[model samples]
Target: LCLALQDRLEKVEKEVQSLKGENLALKLVLEEKKTFASVVKDGEVEVDSWKVVAASATKCTLKRHSAVDLNNRFSTLSDEIRDCGQTRVMSTVIKTVLLLAPAYVYLYINAVYSLKSSHLHYREPLTDLVSQMQETSTAVQNSTNGGHPSTSVYRALEIDHTKASHSLWSEDAQCSKFLVNFGKNIEGTLLLSFPRSGNTWTRYLLEGATGIFTSSVFNDPSLTKAGFLGEVSSLSHNNTIVTKYHFLQKNHHATDPCILLIRNPIRAIASLWAFKIVTSWDVKHVAVIDNSRYNTSEFRNFYQNMLNRWMDVIRNALENSRLRLLPMYYEQLREDPIKEVRRMLNFLRLKPNEERLVCVARHITGKMKGGQKKFNPYTKNEMNQAQEAVKIVNNLLVKRGLPPLPDYSKYEN
Candidate 1:
């Protein structure tokens, strides 16, 4: 009897110790919840602590409901226990077990309450966190798109992070099903510029210097046998394929090195306008400003919009280390075409042969021989508007350590 009594005492002592620990934890949680509830009522929430406060309030609300249900369940269970007269059949040891068991019961009830409260507490925050992630994903897509969602804009939509990137990578649209697919390869050199910035001329010069023909980055069937490519497939040295793109696009191969040809917006505006006369290439994904859209004859505002968009492209390009930038000005091309072509050849890692130099000379002569460019068409007021636009772009580029494109209004072509 003494041994049994002693065992009961030990069990009682252990329960007492456990109950105090559980009691303290519950007190702390409840206090935190109460504090949160008061803060919420006051209508001022610290941004960092807002989530915690919200969670605590939810937990407290859940705890209250759980406690009420638990109280009713215990009352019913106690009545049933007394009516069955089960307590009378117990031996002294069993009775002792029953006497010491309320602490365990209390612990069990508190655990269930805590678990329910905790579940309610975490749910809202988890939902908010997911909402925030979705918002960030959307922001990423829009920001990457320079301006509007189009083929020319380099878009990184939410779908890109999930499944679309995989689809783009695995399936090379350039290949016919009859021809074996050569898989996605992001290797090539990109000759990129704003439209009418001597991009085609540069491409021709680069071709002579490297003995490589250029392809359009876009998959126009008119440009190539393979229509609408995300990137040129092969990266082999034997391949003499350099690609040209009018604008920086979202799917453009970031892995390729680029030569950015910046022209004087004043002159480039005229050059772009004249391109209607010279070429008939079906370019895609580029924003073409219609001459009629300019509300004023000066077109300063019109050129300003293009300049702003171009700067955004340059800023995004600066962020990407993989897209190496080799900037050349159109004015520099006029200063010395041979030197510029040789410098570009160096960038492409190709040596110019006698035949190549001869070809380039012929190419430049042929361009010079072409019909007179829409020359001296703009009034002095129009020229001044262009110069003002150049100053805005120039000041911004100079600070960034990028070369400023010279205003060619004062100089003869």
Candidate 2:
């Protein structure tokens, strides 16, 4: 019976060992389930089955899990790549805009203000909009007192006239009514004369009467003398004025009933000499008795020679049949400008405008100031020399039906 009990104990012990081994296997399986649950919760794997096989099972389940993980990684990498590409494109566009911003702003402001300024706009080709804008600007400028519209208009007209050829005098063959009545049909009237022959005074008197003379007229001395030519040229071209001044060199397309103003040769020489001395401060030191300078010899020879030359120029100018060379003495202009001017008006076939005559008279006389006094009487030697000169000049005057100069001896008192 004791031997039977020992065998039973051994059997009991073996059974206990078996139960422990089973329990350990269950624990391992529970631990594995917990780990797998955690991994699955973290999105590492998805399981098709929970069967635990050891020796006979292949690694198919793990391999399947690895493939799923690889696919997920590929999708994440692809999404990241797409997002990076979009970010790069946006960044490139923003950088381009930043680089061009300054130049764009500069161009915009310049177009609006500087490029559209009035002077700049005038240079642009005329469009419908630009034309309307210019008209409005001109109107506004005219309305404003300080805008100087007249000056601007005058400048524009002057520039246009300057670019035009001045030789267009014969383009219009219309004759003046006065020239028609005077038994002549010519293109234009010319006031012919030598240089420094009171031309400025005459122009001043004529222009001042019309209230057209301004400070600009006399600002430049050279222009003050020749400015009348330009003025009359412009007026003649526009058919505004009937008469004009020609310095004799530019004689083209003659007109009838023109006037000539002549001076006493002796007085003209004296005036010119005085002018030269006063202006140049250079005394002419050549001996008048022996020097051939300026055709001077003794005062007598010079006077007679000058008178002859004067007559020749006048005669040559008178040869033009279209010209009505009215040779008026300079003394007549000084002594009685009104009567002389009236005679000139009558020759011009113009009714003497009393207001214009009065204005002209005032202007000529008003210019004679304190400094324009007559020269002192000739010296004893000068008087004797002048007396001889007067005799020769008087003979020529008498030959031309002009009054002879009085003897200087009679004026010694």
Top lDDT hit? 1
Q: Each prediction's TM-score against the native?
A: 0.42, 0.36
Worst 10 residues of 1 by lDDT: 159-168
Give RMSD (Å) of candidate 1 vs. truth: 27.4
- On a 0 to 1 TM-score scale, where does candidate 1 land against the true structure? 0.42
Candidate 1 lDDT tens digits, 52-103: 5434432321222233343343344333322332123113212222232232
Tens digits of lDDT, candidate 2, 1-413: 23433453344334433542552111112223333233222211222221221112232211112333433433433233223332142232222222332222122112222232233221122122122222323322322111112222211111222221221112323211111011112223344444334544544444433222212111333442433333423323432112434233323433444455555444455444444334322222111111232333444454445545555545545444443434555555655666665444434333334434434543454331112323432345654554555466556545544444444333311
Error of 1 at 9 (Å): 99
How many residue pairs clash in each candidate at the backbone level? 5, 0
What clash pairs does model 2 have?
none
